[model samples]
Target chain A: MKEYLKRIYAMLIYLFLYAPILILIVFSFNASKSRGVWSGFTLHWYSELLKDRQILSALYNTILIAVLSALIATLIGTAAAIGIHNMKKLKKKVIMNLTYLPVVSPDIVTGLSLMILFVFVKLQLGFLSLLLAHITFNIPYVILSVLPKLKQLDKHLYEAALDLGATPLEAYRKVILPEIMPGVVTGMLLAFTLSLDDFVISFFTTGSGVSTLSITVYSMARRGINPKINAISTILFVTVLLLLIIVNIRMSGNHNKKER
Target chain B: MKSKWLSFPYLVWMLIFIFIPLLLVLYFSLTIRTPDGLVFSFDNFRRFFEPIYLKVFLRSVYLALISTVICLALGYPMAMILAGNNFKRKNVMVFLFVVPMWMNFLLRTYAWMTLLERQGLLNTFLTFLGLPPLNLLYTQEAVVLGMVYNFLPFMVLPIYSVLRKIDRQLIEAAADLGADQMTIFRRVIFPLSLPGVMSGITMVFMPAVTTFVISRLLGGGQFTLIGNLIEQQFLFVGDWHFGSAISMVMMVIILLSMGVLSRYDKEHEGGGLW
Candidate 1:
């Protein structure tokens, strides 16, 4: 009876969590535009979504920013993690606290602070600024992810490589890089997802002409009922769902390998 | 092996991006620009203490607190069940909880808007069941519901991770020592799980307090949280001084709360939204 109760409770919680999303997926196929009543099943909204220029442009911007920022952040953050790992305790503490600032600070404050910085520096609030902001917020995550892996690394491995007549750069390349690859990859994936889903920071950092999909959806949803958004939401949901499944499968596969 | 120079690029980036921008916010919060030059003053912060803005701050805290409590109550049991040794397919269950969080937060909040609005899906279902329609949309309750929905995973994932890590032998030992089931849970289980609970509260409360989007969509734009206040100051009101002041105050509040919460969380077992 206790186990049965637990199952029922879990089922109800899952329903509460997914019901909203399921409604969105179902309504995207509704012939009627109104959210209240579904007239019939049709793909009209999806067809309409294909021709929406604003949304397409925003989608393009979103992917571009996510990719570019994640790549740049991974590079810089991995290097910094190594550097911080080798630093004096006091210096490491200061830098680590600074890294934690963006992580712990409210997103609004970060967005506002960055906007202020851009305006003060006279940098144009466009793609460059948005990209810069994404990279800025993303680096800390990468650093945090990679730092742990660095800590777990065998310290003597690089020294052993160095003793084998390899140069310091070659030793690091041959030894340290591969050891920390998992952390670097995790950080990059995290950065990509964060950049992709971001809205508040993008809203403040981007100028009039530039927008991301989240911003577009916010505006559309704010304006009122639009079935086109439902279509877009359905597409995004499925894409993320597929991406997560692949990633999860790969992650578990890697875990099994590590255990072996 | 001790190459510290590789971090130089990141350090430079942080100086230009993170450190200086934060300093600029501090500067703006303290100074007023005039025709002659910038004058340092506390007027911006003083203005924030006015009753109108104070009410907004209090409301944001109140709503965030309520939502965090609700998430804790709802999520703890689910996490406990998922963490149970008897549960099958725990990985799949945890993944199900995480998947929605990975979707666009705006769309998730907007989904609640559809369900709660008058003539929406929930009301339609209610009417079908011969129940009186609920005036749920455009209210504080809707806003809290949206917050709880969005942040519930933050509470669940951390607690679940911690609970999974808990050694079953301790519970078994207590049971062998003649402790009842409830006594075993209270004496052995809950104390060990406090770290996860602390981090969960911090994680959920932080975002819930700072959210502007959830309240805006569900509260029908009439509600204003601290997030919306800062957003309006920068976007619409064009008042950076006051905005920076509010941002500064919020930063202090969040940092202080985190400091207090971390006191209880001794292990620091990676409580982020991974």
Candidate 2:
């Protein structure tokens, strides 16, 4: 009886976590325009998604912003992580803590503060501000992901490179960069995904001309519950799922290769 | 000198981007907004103590607290099941738990909107089953559900990590000594997992309190959390002074919670709630 009760409880929680998503995935193929009940299955929504101008444009904007933010964040974050890693003296731990402040700080505070700052500075509210804000918070994520790998790096390789007359830059490019590339890749992917999917911070920081996918979804979802939003969500779901699978396979393969 | 050159760019960047902006927010929070620019007044903060504003503030705290409790209640058992079970699909389950978190939160909440709207899936199913259709969206319950759905993984992951680290032999010994399942769980597992629970509580509560997007989208702008209030002040009303005051109040609440959690943590675990 006790075992039965525990099993029932676990099954209920599992359903709670997964039922909505399962319903979503299933209804993406509903043939009828009605989202209420399951109709005959069709790929009409996926095809409709292919031609959705607003969604496609929003996707374009999201990608552009994410790419720009990730690139900028990766450079600065990796540099900061490396610099802090190499700093033997001073209150490096304190600096690390401050660097992580943006990560731990709520997005609302970050968004509101950035919005206010943008207004105060008279900066044009557009892609530039969004880019800056994304990079600002994203650097911390990159740092957190990359710093541990940097700290655990084999120091002897760099010393050997230097002993062989390579400059610091050359040593970094050949030795350090190769070793930390996995962390860099993971951090970059994380930053990209975060910036792409972000709603609150982007909602505040984005201007009239720029609409990210998340913002567009929010707007459409607010304007009286459209099926197009569901169609678009299905597209996003499939895309994210594919990327996750690819990343998982790649990471696991890399892990096995490393073990070898 | 060489090291200084290496660090100069970051120092300047941090100074310009972080330190200065933080100071500016602090300064603006103290000053009052006027038609003729600004004046040094505590009026903004004074307005924060008004009944309506305080109610909104307290409501947000209440919502966050309830969401944290719900996540803990649900997440603890899930984490235990995942950690203790020798399952073939453990990796897949872990992936399922985490991967959804990467999905656009707006889209997820929107999906819930579809599921819960009056003319939507839930009502349709209810009507088909010959039951009354219940409208669930745009309510406080909806808000709490969205928060829990969004943050459950955050609670689960930390607890699972901590639970995995716990030695299983201790539990076996307790069972061997004729301790029942409930006693073993209460005296052994629960105490050991408090650190994860505390950290998970911090993670969920902090974000829940300041989440405007979830409240705005899920609550249909009917209910105002502190986050929504802050957003309105800056974006809708264009009143930065009042917004700054609200934001500061929120910051104080968050800091106070952290203080309490850290104190509790130190007493319980000999480490702060880092």
Model 1 vs. true fold: TM: 0.95
TM-score, model 2 to reference: 0.93
Compared with the real two-chain complex, what DockQ does model 2 have?
0.51
Candidate that would win on DockQ? 1
Q: Which residue pairs clash in candidate 1? A: none
**Model 1 lDDT per residue over B68-145, tens place:** 999999999999998997767877788898999999889999888888877888898898999999998889999999
Model 1 chain B: lowest-lDDT 10 consecutive positions: B265-274
lDDT of 2 by residue, B95-165 (tens): 87787787777777877887888877889989999999896999999999999998888899989988998
Q: Which stretches of candidate 1 lie above 4 Å from their native place?
A: B130-132, B267-274
For model 1, report the TM-score of its A chain. Answer: 0.94
